[model samples]
Target: MPTRIVVDPITRIEGHLRIEVVLEGNKITDALSSGTLFRGIEKIVENRDPRDVWAFVQRICGVCTHIHAIASVRAVEDALDYRIPKNANYIRNIMTLTQFVQDHVIHFYHLHGFDWIDVVSALKADPAQTSALAQSISGWPLSSAGYFRDVQTKVKTLVESGQLGIFANAYWGHPAYRLPPEANLMGVAHYLEALNWQKEIAKVHAVFGGKNPHPNYLVGGMASAININGNNTINIERLNLVKTKIEEAQTFVDQVLMPDILAIANFYKKDLYGGGVRNYLAYGGVPTVDVRNPDSYLFPGGIVLDRDLSKVYDIDLKDPKHIQEFVTHSWYRYDDPQAGLHPWQGRTEAQYDGPKPPYENLDENKRYSWIKTPRWQGKPMEVGPLARFIIGYARGNQRMRTLVDDALKKLDLPLSALFSTLGRTLARALETKYSVDHLAGFHADLVANIKAGDSAVFNPDKWDPSTWPATAQGVGYCEAPRGALAHWIKINKGKVESYQAVVPTTWNASPRDAQGQIGPYEASLLDTPLANPDQPLELLRTIHSFDPCLACATHLLNREGEEMLNLRVI
Candidate 1:
């Protein structure tokens, strides 16, 4: 008899989840990843206007809402063939850069730290001792004695702010805590620093967004405008402030963030050789509509396989027919399994598509699932920080390459550094630092263009549905913090006929391999033992690493207490 593994409602990330591992005595033989919470977002947006998608999709992710809104607008613009002003592109990039900074800081201290390090570690830490350490490596700010008192007040506000999420449970003495005390203290101080870092960086978005959490981004060109000092064409002071902040943040990235990642990995040397996949992908980051004719766009999208970490083999995203979705055992319904469909034209029917005689078999095809397995080039792939890290590392540009190489060396190994909790946690930080350091150069060029008075605002009309003579389709794939993600949109009747979105977690936390082979999560659990049958830390480690967000995914609505047309076999 196979052993049954049970994990009921894993906590602390974005959504609800259940885990079951089939164990043969002491070892796991199989795994089942259950995404039990389903919010019917697709049906909610059916009759809404194309523009309202920004607000609707923003609700999908509490942390990365701004990106969702921007991506939606980008896709809609792509369908309408609208050309945005270059100024709009610059503003959009800055907004995204803010989100990236804040998201990176939060990921480092709030989300990933709770699992391995203790919150109370800072409480026991000597203020003088940590301050001295900081000054030694990152001096001046704490050069005075009074500054130490100020730091204490800052730390108090963060821990007591109650805004960083419910992390009191993640403190040093917590029952599940693992890392040594000093490391916890070190991470906690960074936690406070990160909170300040994100809030400050958020100003960039606030200037354009009206506010954070969910910002205002108008579709088909630009919404926010740059104004002069009430008497000029531009607010040179404010713009320069933003420019300065980018540089200041970059300095922090170089001096502190990268070094911290290296220091932390030094303690967890085992992560370098676990769960690595030779395959990689990127949804071609940033826009490349001409400023530089290098053809090597900002984030060149493609599929990468191991043979050398440097070369990435990209798949053309312009070809919609080449991409397809399979909802085999998922809670979706389609007439055929090989349905070459994207989200815009996709359907989510909760009924089982397979024939079944009873409930015991639990055949995936005959079951209702909250998640739909997404495939690229007919196979599932990993995305997010690791994929982005690898892809950017392959680019081997200045800052990204330096930060990544240092991290790789710290893990005491090479390329295989992707698969475990440490890799997942550290990759985002590396990417964050890289972007902060690089976007400055991009901003400088934008300002130089403005100083030269280029007046390069390329805004076009909102969007004329009738004038859209082309019916061609495309998919926009981009790497999010979690993993590989893409949006598939099909336009018809001057409206969105079908829209499909496949997120990073959809690839990483996926249930099973298409041929019924165990997935990465399941495979990782093969030999791991649980301390108690009930509290499976191993399972939680893998799931949380994906940073599961329930709202981001689309699920079927339940009638009363069950799926409307659930099928079962016994």
Candidate 2:
């Protein structure tokens, strides 16, 4: 008999997530990904002014606040055929890039690093050997023996004190952990350093967006006003501050994050697992001067099926036949469970009539998750840094190719390895380095635009609802830190009639479709070797690689004010 393991409320992520795996002896034979909570932000936006939609949608996820705001505004702009100033685009790019840097670094070192580096193992490391390993990887200034000694001492104190804080309840010293004690120590030291580094980088968003989390965004342009001498406006002083922060973030990515990823990859080179859903999808982002042109996007959008890089299929979000969401196995009632509806025609009627929680196993034939299955051309697709990198590489993106090729060469791995769990983690680090390095150029462009006397930010022409048609619809999309995110809206008489968001996690964490095709999370766990069913460290390593964000995927609340279910972590 296959042993079933349930890990509810997967720790170290943004929102509630549960993973149920069936192990045939030591290998996973089946898996189920569940999103436990739901907050219906889509219904909340209904009957609201289109201009105010971004503010409400920004609350979708605290971690991915800016991306939702950006996507929301883009959808509105697309409906009105509005054009923002070039300076506005540049400022928006800088703010979004800063968020990406902050998010990716935090995800790697703080959230996902624990899976690879055992904090308890770090206590056994020789500070001198750790220092040598760190120095060998990069010329990071803090790679001194004394510096590592301090980190080791700190870990020892945390462990001996029996108060591990963030390191608590972790599968420490698990057999799945492959990093040496010295490597673990080095990672832990950098992990602490990242906490400080992220604070400085966050200032970039505040300087431009007026706040860090849930920054202010205007539909026609950015919220920041341009004035060379006024204290209230985004003056030269504020621009310089943003520049300095971007440079600081770049230095950390280059000297610390990138090198650390390569070092960790070296240790787990042979452990190939978690290459889920080879079909990749990316809605191109980081627009240059033109937001409408897909070709000019820094991250081009396309669909790659069956891991074939030679041909990339173009995706048109407006086409009802292209992108659709199916609630076949989700806790929602659609007009037809088998029929996939595009976001424009999407419905979010909650029907939690499935087997109640507190049950041991989910009936796969019935609804098991709150996340609806989002398919591109009726096929499950994986998104995120890995998808973006692969699509960029396939499209002859020289920078992406160069960065990926260089990393692969360093790890002594082939291009094929980019499909595995390690590759997904490494792609985020690579994209961070790329984003940080190019941020200066974007900043320079913004400065040039301002100096050339193009100081306008927000265009108030479309602020009035009377200017809009009786009905208009548009799709706004951008690649969030997790993956491709889009917000679809239909405005009737300047008020939102219908709104839907197909987030990144929805693409990766969906349950089985009507065809019984497993989603990325389920497919990835199949055949994964488990060291200990009780301590499923290997399972986490694969899932965390995608940096799951369940809060953004399923956002609804129970109005009954009753505890629907409880998770017992074992």
Candidate 3:
């Protein structure tokens, strides 16, 4: 008999997620991922001004807030055929890269680190040994015995006081944890350090976007105006502040984040459990000098099927035959449940007729999740750092290829290892290093352009809706920290006719399709071994590797402001 395990409201993530796995003995035979809440953001943005869509969409997820704004503005600009100023492009790039640095670091140290590091076990670590381990990895300034000792004492106090606060509710002494006490202590110390580091990193976003969580964005250009002398505009002092913050972020990545990931990877080199769907997709992000050209994108977009890197296919988001969403096993009412509709024609009418919540097992044959299956050319695709890394490595990108090769060499692992759970986590760390290293160059270019007297930021020509055609449609896409994200918008007489956002988690956390094909999250759980079915730490390791952000995936709320679906742990 297959033992069923249900983990509701998976903690430490952005939003509510419930994972159900049918385990035969100790290995997972099947799995189901459910996004329990729905915010109806697509419906809220309807009949609104097209220029202001980014502001509304930016609230989809607090963690992925800025990317939503960026994608929204890009979609509107695409429809208007608006070409923004070069300075605006550079400024946007800088902001995007800063978000990447802050998000990836936080994800690794805070969100996903607990999956590996045992906080309770850290209480037994020798601070001297932890310092030695840290020193062996890198010459980080904070790798001192005193620092590790203080971290160990703090953990001891938390454990003794029986109030871990943020460290509470974790599977602290799980058998799946492989790191030693010293390594766990090091991870915990860096975990606390990253909290302080991220605060400073957020200042970079405020410098350009006017706020941190949901920043201001303009369709034609960035919100910040370039003026070297004026106090009212983005003056020289503000630009210098941006430069200093970029340097601080870069130093942290080089000295702390990258080294810590490599150290953790060394401990779990042989554990190869979480290799999900091999088919990968990425809508290129971080545009270069030309925002319109895909070839100039820092992260190239393409589809790789069956892990075959040699044959990458170009994806046109506008092509109806390329990208489509299917709701056969989701709580959505489409004209045809089995049919896949392109985003421009997507609908979000809810139909929650599946099994009610507080149930033991999900009828996988029926609707199981609120997330619709998003397929690229009718195939399930994995997106995020792993996908971006694989796509970039396949495209012969020198910087990406070098980063992956060097990391693999350091770990003494073969290229095939990049397909496993550890590979996915390591990919995020490597990408962070690459993103932070390029921040200085982006800032320098922005300074040069501003000094050259190109102070233009916004284009007022298309700011009015009367200039638009009778009907216009466009797709705005960029790689969010989690994976590929795109917003499709349809406008008529200057008002939003239809707005659909196909987010990263929509692809990763989707359910089975009409043909009974499992999505990435479901497929990844097959054959995963469990040390303890009650704890299910091994399961979270794989799922968190994808960095699931359900806040952007499903968002339908009731009048009382409670989650409509009740998740019961059984």
Tens digit of per-residue lDDT, candidate 3, span 1-570? 988998887888898888999999999999999887677788788889988889899999989999999999999999889888888899889889999999999999988999988988988888999999999888778988899998888888887898889998888889889999999998999899999999998998898888898888999998888789989889999999989998998888998889888888988998887888889999999988766888899998898899998988999999999999999998888877789999988887777887765576788878888888899889999999999999999988999999999999999998889898899999999999989988899999989888988888887887777778989989899999999999999998889998999999999999988888888888899999998998999999999999989999985543333445554444
TM-score between candidate 3 and the true structure? 0.97
Best of the two (1, 2) by lDDT = 2
**Candidate 2 overall Cα lDDT vs. reference?**
0.90
Model 3 clashing-pair count = 5
lDDT of 1 at 389: 68
lDDT scores in order: 0.61, 0.90, 0.89
Worst 10-residue lDDT window, candidate 3: 556-565
Candidate no. 1 TM-score: 0.83
- Any runs in candidate 3 off by more than 4 Å, and if so which? 556-570
Model 1: residue 14 alpha-carbon error in angstroms: 1.7
Give the per-residue lDDT of model 2 (tens digit) for 1-570.
998998887988988899999999899999999887687788888899988999999999989999999999999999999888888899888887888999999999999999889889999999999988998879889999999998888889988999998889999979889998999999999999999999999998888887879889999998889997889999999989888998888889989999999999999988888898889999999898778988888888999999999999999999999999999899887777788998999887777866554677777888889899999989999999999999999999999999999999999999999988899999999999888877898999999989998899888887777888899999899999999999999989888988999999999999999999999989989989999889999999999999999989985433332333443434
TM-scores for candidates 1 onward, in order: 0.83, 0.97, 0.97
Candidate 3, position 165, lDDT:
92
